[model samples]
Target: MSTQVPPIHSTAAAPMLELRGVHTHIGAYHILHGVDLTVPRGQLTMLLGRNGAGKTTTLRTIMGLWQASQGRVLLGGEDITRLPTPAIARQSVAYVPENMGIFADLSVKENLLLAARQARHAGQMDEERLQWIFGLFPAVQKFWNHPAGKLSGGQKQMVAVARAIVEPRDLLIIDEPSKGLAPAIIHKMIAAFEQLKAAGVTILLVEQNLAFAKRLGDSVAVMDNGRVVHAGRMADLAADTDLQQSLLGLAL
Candidate 1:
């Protein structure tokens, strides 16, 4: 019932993360079917798919939240398929789920403080880095003392990303950062991600917004029926309207 995806060539000399023939099962339902993906180092890779297409499942599997039933997940040339979630995170990888994952009961500052392993208190967190993050997402500074739950959706999203980057990370994986956000907030998010990429962070994003993907992604992989149906440069996919509609069921 599924159409086949032609092989996608590697655009980067070396990939920062790769999923090779991965399979994931949820209860009796098989989610990912031999998914192959590559995220190049220091680049923004977009994972796009229709609903029920297993984009989030793929991200979760990479994060070790859901164990892969088969295959390998490589990070920086190391096999991390079986590592625990914390261990994976400690490997300089950060994952932000769709829920924004901030502690609603904690203040924005507290939430960020908790994310930094070296910092016990706000004073202990890297001052220069914190300032840089604040500059990228000013909402974080504006709502510093407010409970994360009290902030608006967009501000909370900022806190979530700020927490992920509270410390330097090699890879950052986020799920649908633009979901339910206003156009203006989404634009700001786009800018923040651009800055993060500039700071040498390799990012893997599971997004449904075509405009967001086109704006920020250097590489793209499209999933359907749990397999990557397309992989190539973002510009290649963006420029081909017919191919976009075929893979994603919509024009770019």
Candidate 2:
């Protein structure tokens, strides 16, 4: 009913985040069958799967939003499986879900300021960190006074990304960024991710868009029926037509 993933990410070097023998269950459904994944420090790793393949659930389990029924989730050498979502986030993990969290009624600056406030020791929106997000999206600077609900879809996405990174998290988990956007807008999102990667942020992304995934992923894991069947360097996945056709149903 499920396939075992090959040992792809070597342990010669310790990873920034490692999920070993992870098993998760929801109600009567069991997901993440013994999932093993390693996200190396400072590299972008992606999780790919068709709908219902447990990609989004896997991200949720890692975030401890949905506690794993079984497994060890380690982040930068700390065991985080039992930690709460807020604790995990404070430990330097950020998430940008498919529904990019934007306060529709809030101004662009207000939304960003709220996100940055998470890292603030005792305040909301650290001024220095707020400036960094503003710098990253000059458009944000242009729309500081504008309501988020009025911004374009791409601009909303920009707000989402800016919010995730404002606190300078050690790991960023982004889910399905290309779901309903125009190709041009997806490219813009990709470019922003590239900039984040260049800034030395570690990212673990769950993506359905093959073209977009290949472009930013240093490594990839393909999930099928709640199991990881393929894991390897992004370049290997990109060049292997047979693997793609047989396992992923999509070829580069």
Candidate 3:
């Protein structure tokens, strides 16, 4: 039987975020099954899989949304497996979930302020950081005074992503970025992520859009049945039609 040995960077620089055989349960039912994944320093790694493959759950596990039932979650090589959600947020990790989680009544500035307040440890995020965020997604600047509730779907999505890393994070976990958006809007969002990556943000992206994933991913992990089934360089997978068809059930 041929098995793909997922290439894990065994270096000492320390991964920005990592999950070692993580297991999680929601309510009375267990979900994640021994998931192992890692995000190297300054790398844009993608967790790609179809629905129900535990992609979002994996992101939740890292963000301390669900405390791992087993295994370890490390932020900069320190064990954070038992940390609370708020505590995890303070660990230089930012999470933008599938739902976006925007405060409908809050204005764009208010949303950014909330994230800044929560992340403003040791004067971590200053005016400069906030400006940087606004610059990355200029649309946010235009809607600064506008209430998020009145924003369109694409605008809200931009705000959700902006709020998550407004304070600057060592690691960013983004879930299903391209879901339910016009192709044009998705293109704009893609550029925003590219800017983040170019600025050296280590990202763990959980996305279903294969074409989008190929654009930003330095490496890819295709998950299924709650475990990673295939992992390789994005370029390698992009060229292998058979691998793409067999694992992701996608053409090209």
Candidate 4:
């Protein structure tokens, strides 16, 4: 059985996700300053920035982990700015945090099981989707019964991502999927993401890996001082070295 996701044309549809003039305050600190971003339907949007530039904060605000002090978050044109985290998640959005949130003590299968809300047990889980995920990350299957804590960093990261896709998701927001990964593992990660893109998942990624970003990103947004300073096609950004230097202080 084919598990291919139906493609949504990137140019013709409204954005899968949008943030307008978003502001977030983490305790006494104001982290985000009116971030405006658009994740086009069925395309991967890379969020690039220097450290502490509020990339992660913007993602968190969209996921409702951090409430926006101002502005709005919209998913499929529905206002979700003030929705609780669970409510937002129920709207078919999946978030993989920078920390790669997973239960260390739980088996890899158990970790994935928790993400399949409609499935109360492994038998009830979607076999086709599980097989599809295994094709993307074999480590998840190889370590199915092993404690997630026992897996290496790359494997754990794989499990984190695999968990997010256990069920079909309309939008996937991942923070640094390539961070702290070995080159070989990063290559596999890139391939998996490419397949995800081909399958028409609308993804927003906060990535410091410019090479990885260039390969998988369809659209690019560069953040600095808590605001997006540049937004355009990934190819345009990749082809312009001076623009890369100005926005990111480095070439792709």
The candidate maximizing lDDT is 1
lDDT of 4: 0.92
Error of 2 at 89 (Å): 0.2
Span of ten consecutive residues with least summed lDDT in model 3: 3-12
Which lDDT tens digits does candidate 2 get at residues 89-207?
Answer: 88878998888878999998777767665544324566776676666666677887799999887788878888788777778999887777788778767877887889888999988
Error of 3 at 40 (Å): 1.1
Minimum summed lDDT over a 10-residue window in model 4 is located at 4-13
Between candidates 1 and 3, the one scoring higher on TM-score is: 1
Off by over 4 Å in 4: 1-12
Off by over 4 Å in 3: 1-12, 118-127
Weakest ten-residue segment in model 2 by summed lDDT: 5-14
* Cα lDDT of model 3 by residue, 1-252, tens digit: 976634444346888877888888898878888988878888889898878998988888887877789888878878888899999888778888898999999888888778886554424557687777677677788988899999888888889998887777878888888888889889988888888888898988988888888888898888998888887787789889999898888855
lDDT, residue 183, candidate 2: 86
Q: Give the worst 10-residue stretch by lDDT in candidate 1.
A: 5-14
Model 1, residue 62: distance off in Å is 0.4
1: Cα error in model 4, Å: 59
Clash statistics: count for each candidate: 0, 1, 0, 0
